[model samples]
Target: MFGWLRRKFGKTDRFARLDATQFPRFAPGTVWLVGAGPGAPGLISLLGYYGLGEADTIVYDALVGPDLLAMANPRAEMIYAGKRGGKPSPKQADITLTLIEHARAGKKVLRLKGGDPMMFGRGGEEALALARESIGFRIVPGITAGVGGLAYAGIPVTHRDTNHAVIFLTGHDEKGGVPQAVDWPAVSTAAPVIVMYMAIKHLGSIAEKLVAAGRSPEDRLAVVSNATLPSQSVVETTLADASTLAARTDIPTPAIVVVGPVSRYRQTLDWYTGGENALG
Candidate 1:
């Protein structure tokens, strides 16, 4: 009987980082890392909704949906921590420190981020910082860009016949340029559906690496900008033509690139092409 108990309880420490009891109760002193989903307010999960309502202060990014912010308690204080590549913004360390300070004050702090907090949202850094300070916090997952944004553009990451696996990768590194650590050949051969974030600026070099890695130039590719938002736009092309098409257009950051046979689904499944909606 003791052996059985040891097996069950010994594994508990593996997930101790996310223990709910370690975190303060939802009364008035707690911190929640809430994902606002990818651009759309309706895409936010119920857990995100609950965190917003209980927030005493909300530190939000620029990408967060405005409609979602409206859901926050009327008395909640809002702080802007939006960071854009090549633009001036608050330092990440500063943001993390602020979260710690807010939580230490015994306030219900909500660090609202766009897309899933753990997916390229830098939530891990904040969580680590919080843990080091011995501050209790909770992480609430939301729809990430690779999943939610592609859906809004009528592109599925995987299709039963086309692909059984998908891979989400960032185009840029901490310095905001193409990442050199990525093994192009391995990724090219392994992942049928490849979605990139912040890679619009380096699309030319990225395409070259994939091509050298044996990814066909004719492979279907789609770039969805401002995904899931009213101002969303999509540029459809092949891997070889993607860089050229992007250069000629104004598609900016907050974009997602999908490459694979699954991209062909956009032709028929795209509901945003009717021009009746805000997406161009």
Candidate 2:
């Protein structure tokens, strides 16, 4: 089956040369939850690439890149299940039902999410739904934006010289407000580095909370937008002025906000900037 796909596409690059047999089959009547990686289609794993070629139905999220979608079988059914903040989106339950519906029909279903499906992407919720219905599914991990996106901005989540601990959290809860469960004061002090997803909306309040919780106002931070893609842009600022700077700047969503000393390292390691510092 794999050989036939390669021949049909008439491509012999490294991706096409991969032995699909080495990976789990995207069998019929099963759903595969695959991550498309940050913003780079090339970052997708070989198993994820194989699933794209075999799936009869692909249910993808907002952040999944067009390049990855284009790799799907030309004849495959495409379903949009993207959920963006402050935008009208599909209900999570409905998406789960859609996956179940396709799988029950004996179709090879692909649930392709942007970034790691389990990392703030709601893969666990969908996976639980599949389990409750006795549906067979597989997980294909991808590079999460918290790490990959930061790397694109030349920010490391951790460094030997810097602190060892890091924390990843969402900017909002299910209600689209600051998460009350998180002890902001404790987190501000405990975690040496913090990476926030979907936090742009509440950045002002979050920064205030962090500041009141003992974090230094002068702490370095960066906001990386369109990470790993051609239109990628990064904004560097201090925690004291993160909210003000972000509002004034056009750095768009699907962005990652990184706060820590590691942000300063971007000046030295920003490979994307051609030896120039990415700090703004």
Candidate 3:
């Protein structure tokens, strides 16, 4: 099942050298929620790798890449509970129920999610449901796309020269519309940089709100798609034109949108597949 390890490490027991005690066993009857990291399999944490190798069942989200899934024990039960906006997806409650059912049956259950499990991925909700059922669980954090994806796009979330403070926000609410709770006036001037997750769908409305709340319409914004993967693409625009630019059907999803001067850093720090983080 861990054939990748043999292919990569060539039979070296690296774990033994690094202290085997640090790599904890994936005990049966406990559920582990692990972030698979933005779209790349290699970004998965060590604990995540261990959990995959030992898990009896893996309940994975839509954004979790197939490469990461290929690392799991071949005999493990794989459940797809991916939630794509506006698509037919499994209900959250039912997915949690699956974890509880698997754990109660004395199986090593793993919840594989994209980005940080707790960052807009609904990992907290699932964990709460598991706790209510008295099912033991662990959280293995990974690089969130809001942070890692921007880095791949060569845009810093925060820079000493530009923004000293930053805000992370989800673009939509339970109804899948622009978040009504965001205090537009307060947040518009609150942080130097604002990173929005899943906001592309409602960018036109959101941009209007921010501009009305004192944010400059000409503020820089970049949309990073399929982050950290070879297929990744960056679209740069001003907040004034963000809606019109994102309106193109070609722009990919599972994207992170950044608003601020941080995106301008791509001119220098960009190391990923890039020509220019500028609008064509």
lDDT, candidate 1, 1-280, per-residue tens: 1222225346645434433433335645567998999988888886677677668999999898678887777678999999988789999989998898888888889999999999989999998888888888899998999998988888888889899888888988888878988988999989788999888888878988999999999998888999988788888889999779768757766789888898777767777654334244
RMSD of each: 10.1, 2.4, 3.0
Model 1 misplaced stretches (Cα beyond 4 Å) = 1-27, 275-280
TM accuracy, model 1: 0.87
lDDT of the candidates, in the order given: 0.82, 0.88, 0.89
Model 3 ranges with Cα > 4 A deviation: 1-4, 7-21, 275-280
Ranking by TM-score: 2, 3, 1
Clashes of 2: 0
Residue-wise C-alpha lDDT for candidate 3, range 1-280, written one tens digit per residue: 4444555557656544444346777889999999999988989988898888889999999998888898887779999999999999998889989999999999999999999999998889988998888888999998999999998888889899998999999999988988989898998999989999999899888998999999999999999999998889999999999779867888899889999989888987787774364332
True-structure Cα RMSD, model 2: 2.4
lDDT of 1 at 94: 90
Give me the displacement of residue 107 in model 1, in angstroms. 0.8
Highest TM-score model number: 2
Clashing pairs in 3: none
**Which 10-residue span in candidate 1 carries the lowest summed lDDT?**
1-10
Q: Where in model 2 is the C-alpha error above 4 Å?
A: 4-9, 13-16, 276-280
